[model samples]
Target: MQVTESGADLLALLRELDDPQWLEWPTSYDRSAVAARFGELVARLEGDFGVPCVAEQDTQDSSEYGRATVPAEATVCGTRIVVCVSKFGSLALVCAENPGAYLGTQDAQEEGELDDADLASVERALVELGFTVVPEELVESDYDGPSRAHLYGQRPTWWDRFFGTF
Candidate 1:
């Protein structure tokens, strides 16, 4: 069956079934496994629909989940669908302008430098995909324990104290 860009229909289809019933979830499903799953899904979708579906894996460490973007083609609707599947069966699909657009927005958001237009576009895309996109002000609220652990080691003790003050 071919999947269309109608958010409601897509959501219904996804909610009606489970992926685990068809594919085995690896115990140690790391980034590689996620990428492989993305590739597999794209291949299946393309074969079933007989269209060109390009799948690209986002390997950035800061992302909450691994991402795969499939562009729309002649047979498919003009939608750029981003699939993010967690190791535990949880999956989210965010439809945006395109992979390049979404990634650019993400990069700006991560850097806390997103312009108003870009931010609006991102919000619109997320909302269209039925997601409650968090505001930038509230995005970094949860900071505790290992979740906030600095990937890079601390500078000087003085710099550490001055870090948040700025």
Candidate 2:
């Protein structure tokens, strides 16, 4: 969803999706697993970029639980960036113009000298680490989130939506 989306928009979307039971906290959600993945991701990022990794979580948000948004940040190519990650395995790289500006729930906010090639390398690292990195062009120019309709003649599941896998 867009960073500009309102709370009402989120509610509408959830209701439209029939209030997916899996979204309920402590149901299908595994907090420990999510946290562990975050740690691993941070380590991977640090190694890939040759920089220290720092992460910020969302445990204080009252309206947020069961969901993941472990954004790990670091400096690469002399530019600070935040790698937004989620439990669903979606990731986005944001130039760290503002601290904590990027999260797994929203689009990226960027303001650095990270050229396309640099961003591509970052995406490659994420993909190598087994995270689904959406093409920046599609996300920046044509993102509509995931479709519930038969995308490419197949009904989309959460797996397909986030991981590009069946």
Candidate 3:
């Protein structure tokens, strides 16, 4: 039986898949599988989609076992995207226009012409790559006292936050 499926076929399979376990990491050994899948997609992103791709791995061990710090650069359908598997398992393929002023990745400054439709296309690509891509509510940082103050000029409070007050 052929297990590997084409992109459109896989996407159709994803649409029909209702099992939450579909996205779960099956075994610890699967990290390499995930990374290999990611690498294949990166090739497609660059070669088939005409997106410039750059991949940075923090370490080999990190890549093999840990969250797999594969921060990739791509331009899909005119949208310059930063495809990264965050330290957590959030596989985010965000447009590299402006991620966050202080907290976002530095590489997001490399802008492109990706619009809303392009973003949807990117999301489909992510889904095809076996990512859940759940929507998360933005949470306020708890480092309010000083780290927040230092980072965003929020005005220091009683404590210094990360380290002691200077």
Q: Which structure among the candidates has the greatest lDDT?
A: 2
Name the regions of candidate 2 deviating beyond 4 angstroms.
Answer: 1-27, 62-77, 87-112, 134-166
* lDDT, each prediction: 0.38, 0.41, 0.37
Q: Could you arrange the candidates by TM-score from highest to lowest?
A: 2, 3, 1
Say which candidate scores most in TM-score. Answer: 2
User: Candidate 2, residues 8-49: lDDT per residue as tens digits?
Assistant: 553344334322233313244566766666667677666766
Give a tens-digit lDDT track for model 1, residues 51-131: 666554453332334444544442233444444433333343333443334344345445443344433433444344444
Task: Rate residue 72 of model 3 by lDDT.
Answer: 31
- What tens digits encode model 3's per-residue C-alpha lDDT throughout 29-137? 3556656766765665565455455665432422111121112343333334554442224233243442332232223223334444445554566667765442211
TM-score of each: 0.35, 0.46, 0.43
TM-score of model 3 (CA atoms): 0.43
Candidate 1 local distance difference test against the native: 0.38
Segments of candidate 1 deviating more than 4 angstroms: 1-28, 64-66, 75-77, 86-90, 98-166
Candidate 1 backbone clash number: 0
| Model 2 alpha-carbon miss at residue 160, Å | 21
Root-mean-square deviation of every model: 13.0, 11.1, 12.4
